[model samples]
Structures are given as structure tokens and as C-alpha cells.
Target: MATFTPTKPRTIGHVDHGKTTLTAATTKVLAAEGNAKAIAFDEIDKAPEEKERGITISRSHVELPIVSGSGLYALQGTNEELGEKAILKLMDADPVRQLYRPFVMPIEDIFYIQGRGTVATGHVEQGTIKVGEEVEILGLTQGEPLKTTVTGVEMFKKLVDRGEAGCKVGLLLPGLKHGDVQRGMVIAKHGTLKTYKKFEAQIVYVLSKFYLRTADITEKVQLPDDVKMVMPGDNVTATFELTLPYPLDHGQIFSLREGDRTVAAGVVSKVLS
Candidate 1:
């Protein structure tokens, strides 16, 4: 018996080039060989417009079994032409394991222990942190990054020596008073984070009224003169100017709220100044 890896192969070419038909035929052949359960001709194109014009106008995903290692693979080009060597090469070139992101924790709440000093609590947005490592407090005082050392880390009321992305942990910062840190300040590895006052973002699902909320501060967004109001499902590139600087990075997500309700969201595309 041969081991198989689940792969999603994409077909790309000019329109009306039988891409859908080719995908349908591949599924049929795999089903005939007892690899796949059934053909997916109808599944490839279910939209009314696609059936009328016989062309795929949107993206579709289909799973096919390929003989390879245990992990999933995204096979490009012709699936039938991919051999064991090609599959192994694709697996070796996997970009997921090569990424290295720095530690970033946005302070949501702060507390001062009577004996230990200031404790900043927030979820680790990315990367990992260990005790005794130095971190910078950003977005607090304008143009100033406060350097502090992580003396201890606690999570869920238990002391921990290290923390990683997605974990809510409280870092013990010595020599800092309760007044030094505030909500919305980001604790990050020194020199890894930067403060920005203006940025470009792609806004979508625009509600009737929305304000950009970040770091416990809410600011109303001013739109361009030509645009009156942003509607739902609108994808527009807009520039945001903040009254105060924020520790921001590309690809960071922020929410658009209307009063007490969150109406939309956007991702930071580029940071300007």
C-alpha cells in the first residue's frame, strides 16, 4: 500500500480554456482509480452564471490525493505531471517554517504589585518571549521607547519562564511605577516595533458610521471629499491620520466601530511617517 498526501492543485490559464472541464475529468479519473470517492463536475461550478457561460469566474477548492509525505501540499501546474521528486522539492521549499516574527504584546491592562512593580498584561500578538529578556514600551510617550527587562512572567495565575504568540501573560517590569505604562502601549522586543501617526489601509464592509478604535482611544475617520459615506462591501484604500502616534506594523488588524458596536475591520497596508 502506498501512502498519499492531500493536495490542492490550482488550474490557471486564459478564460474558456477548459479549466473546469480538465478539473472535472481529473476527479473522475481519480474516482475510477479508487483514490477519490466521487467526481466533482457539478461541484466545480455551481453558480448560475458559470453554468450559463461554461467558465469559472470565481475561485474553487478541491482536494485530491497524491503520493507523498504526510503533510499537505499545494501543487501548482499540472497535477498529473508532478512526480515524487517534484513533490519532495515543494515540501522542502515550504515557506511556513522559514518565517521569523518578533514579539509584540499590546498592553490592554496594567497593574502594580506592591513588591514586584508594574505588570503589563496582554496577549502576545506574535513571536515568543522569555524571562530576563529586555523589551521596549512603545506608544506611550511621544517619540520615546521605554526599555525594561522582563523579570518574571505569569499566566493563568501560574508562574512561567517563557510565553509565545496568542498567550495572555502578565510581564513583571521592575523599576517602573503604575503611572509609567498605560493601556494601548505595546511591549515589544527592543527595536522591533515603531510608532506611526499616519498609515494606509484597505477598508472593507464599510458601515454607515464607523470610527477607528485602537489602544483604548477612538477617533473618527475623515473621508475624502468625493466620497460621501462608505457602504457595505466597499473595498477602498484610505489614509488614516491619528491625533497621537501608535505602535503599528504592516498587516496589523484594527476594528471599525460605530458607537458601542463593531461594524467593520481593516488591515494596515503601509505606514507613512
Candidate 2:
């Protein structure tokens, strides 16, 4: 077996970017090139539509074999518990009664995409917050809509006290008012947040109608601000100038736009001219 150390956490990117295709291709290529059956991986079948659409909807686990000894023995993937057999057993046992339970597992300090919006119920992996601690709801503009604090926390026999990381959390706010705030936004705790409206970022190009350069027309820019110009050159890197009043923070991930669609997604590097 091989032993490896990770410098950065590994999480699956969502579908539509050919995540599934990428997985299959990479898996087959590795298996063909390698001598052994290569370690196994767990693919999360979270959505029926994902199967139909031929895209990976849930977070799946894949084992990457390290080249160490002649006969490898160790195996590593994302999650070992949520396998297909375990999931099938759970689903077949008593879904109706078990629907009101918190996750059989726990997720903390991780990012996930919302496949659906459903009622929230249960004791979360992490305890729920009180009415004092501030929380920031993101995703309204490409993050999640997080409602921190216990101002409206309630007890439900079926619902959990807190929400897990991977599942969707529905908030029942009576007098809340957010106009035209649709899906695909992220919500989180509000604090001394970071900003970098006009900065450089590293990105991987997925879909491109035509090769882009500085000042190329793009609709991937979605900040609540105006863009002065765009520059592209370095491999998976670009320079962006925003005309918004909000702040852009370091390490923020955003889907870059050319005109009306996302061209690439990237993390903020540095504010450049």
C-alpha cells in the first residue's frame, strides 16, 4: 500500500462541468496504465436526476493510489461509511421513520452544493448556535443563505437541533424579506469578511466558446458591481476589475463570467490593476 499526505482538502466539484465524465476518464486511464486493480472508490448516488443526466450529483469518493512499494496495500477515499450498500440498506429499512433523523454522519467546515430545498429537522453534527452569536448567510449572490444565532431556533421532535454540512437547511423566517434572491447563492456567518474586488485569481478553464484574452467579452462576472476590464494570460490565471461597492476577500471562489454565462471558476489571488 502507499501512504500520502494532502496539502489541501479534496472535495468534489459540482456537475455540469463534466465532473462525472472527468471521473470516469481519469479512473479508466489510471486502471489501464496501472498493473493492479487500483484501489476502489465510492461514488455517491445522491440524485436520480444525476443518474439520468449522467452527471455526478452527490459527493463521491475515489482512491488515488500512490506509487510506493511494489505491492501496494493501503486504500484511501473520501468517505467509507456512505457506500452504496450501506445507503441501500438504510433506504430499504424504514425511510419514513428515519427521515426525521440527523445525518448518520457529520460534516463540519466543509462546502456543499444544495441539490434541493427541503424542511430542516434534527440534532446537527455540531450543536446549534444561541441567539447571540452572529452568522452570515451567503449564496444570495453565489453562496449559501446562512441564518446564524438562535433568535428563531425551535425544537422539533422530527427535526434536528442543527444541520449537517452536506444537507440543505431550510429556514422559516416569518417577516424576512429578500426580493429576487434565487438559488445558487451561499450563506454563512457575517464578520470581518475579506474583500478583493479588483484582483488577480487562479482559474481552470472548463468551457470556452472561443479562447479569451484581456477585455474579451464575458458574462461570467456576477458581482453586484461593474467590471472595468478583464485580462487573461498566465495558465489558469486572470486579472479582474470590479466596479461594485462591496468588498472582495482573499481566498474567495467565484464563477467567472464572459457575458451571460460562467467561463471559469477561480480563487482570488491579489488585487491588480
Candidate 3:
């Protein structure tokens, strides 16, 4: 008799977390050492304004080379061919794809959440958000709202608690109706979320109404809550507050900016006063 082992799927996280840089480095090393072949995706659009602002307003998939076997490859831009080793697939699909189809119950609101936190809701906009998967926040071109990973899940009064990624999930958050879920709140296991009060982060200004000044608090509106304002100066570090409960953790990253500059880095701290 032969033993059985499962082959893991080829997947990659969102490209924002320096994944592209790492991929390029790995490809160079592989080619230089003659170990493997690397595939690259270089698609250009009129969105440098959005991308430089650190927001990926669109969804795309990219495939690279890993350690598997040899094959014909598909690169984004050109009809070029390269030797194959294994294939690495890079996809940027939000969990909402499952809920949407050609025609269906129209979602009254298209809620958006920035990266890697949690969103609380009875119904997703279109598709099912896989457990432990990061969903894209699609709206403004500033950048993808956030890259959040689903850590836990529950459906209705009963907890289906665990399920495989890429599967449709019907969840139920107690005492919370479908309408109660605001877009910004990342959904995960109830009570597992740590809402933030204050923190210091880096931000860039993009299509903003006014220039952000130091110490001048401002408010950013997302669905259920508003991101309290902070007068940040051109990609500078500053303090911020959240208007509602946010599921946050120490070192967890969110998007911010001062003006024209996108991509602000922040670390969570104590609750607001």
C-alpha cells in the first residue's frame, strides 16, 4: 500500500507587502545560479497615480516560477517564452466574487475595507470570503483599502467555525443583521478582534481636499466608522484615532497619508482618550 499526501495549492499573498520585490530577487537568483526559470508579469496602465498612491484599485492575477516541474508559461504583457521549473500564481481576487454573478440580488451598498484586518457582516457584496484569505477593498484609487486575513468565522447562531479557503461561506454574527455590518469592520471570529484607539502611522496625500497639517485632527469616512483625523505632514508620522471599534493588533498595518502621498505606516497603541 502507498501512503497519501496532499499537494498544497500554489498561492501568494497581496503584492503590496514587498512581494513583488522578493519575487524579482528570487527570479534573479534562480536565473543566475541556473537552478530554475522565472516568469514575470509587467502590465502597465494609466494608474501610476493610483499605484504610487499605494492603492491597487483593480484586481489582477500574476504567475511566476517556483519549484515544481516544467511547462509553457503565460506572461502578462508580451508573448515571450521562458524555460520552466515550477509555476507561481499571483492572484488578487476579493472574497466578494462569489456573491456576485451576471445578475443577482443587487447589493445596496458596495462596502470597502482596507487590507489584513477583519470585516463583520452577514452578507458579503458578491462572493464568499475564504477563511484565512485576504479580501481587497475596492473603491478609491488611493490603494486597496487593506489586506486582511480571515482568522476565524461563524455562521448564524451556530458556528461553522472552520472551513477551507475559496469555499462559499454562509455566516451569522449574533444580534447583528446584514444591514448592521459597516464596511470597515473586518470580519473574523467574534470577540477575537482587538479594536484600536490610537496609533502613529505614515501617510501620503492623494486627491485629498486639503493639505494635512501636523496635529490637526481630521476624519475619514468608511462604512460603519470614521477614521479620526490627524494632521500629518507629507508622508510624516503622526497620531490617529478611530471613530468606531476596529479589529486591530500591534504591528497590524492600515493605509493612511498626509496629502498627494499615499502609504502611511502606523503601529497600534492604547485606546483614545
Q: Which numbered prediction scores highest in lDDT against the true structure? A: 1
Q: Number of clashing pairs, model 2?
A: 51
lDDT of each: 0.68, 0.37, 0.36
C-alpha TM-score for every candidate:
0.59, 0.34, 0.34
Clashes of each: 0, 51, 40
| TM-score result, candidate 1 | 0.59
Candidate 1 collision pairs: none
Model 3 residue 257 CA deviation in Å: 6.8
lDDT of 2: 0.37
Cα lDDT of model 1 by residue, 67-133, tens digit: 3421111122245434323344432443232114888888889988899889989878778888899
User: Number of the top candidate by TM-score?
Assistant: 1
Q: What is the full ranking by lDDT, best candidate first?
A: 1, 2, 3
Per-residue alpha-carbon lDDT of candidate 3 for residues 27-139, written as tens digits (9 for 90 to 100): 54355557557544233223886557654444433233344322223222222223222222222222323333211111123223344233243343223434445433221
List model 2 lDDT by residue over 207-239, tens digit each. Answer: 332112111222233222353344353235555
Q: Candidate 2: TM-score?
A: 0.34
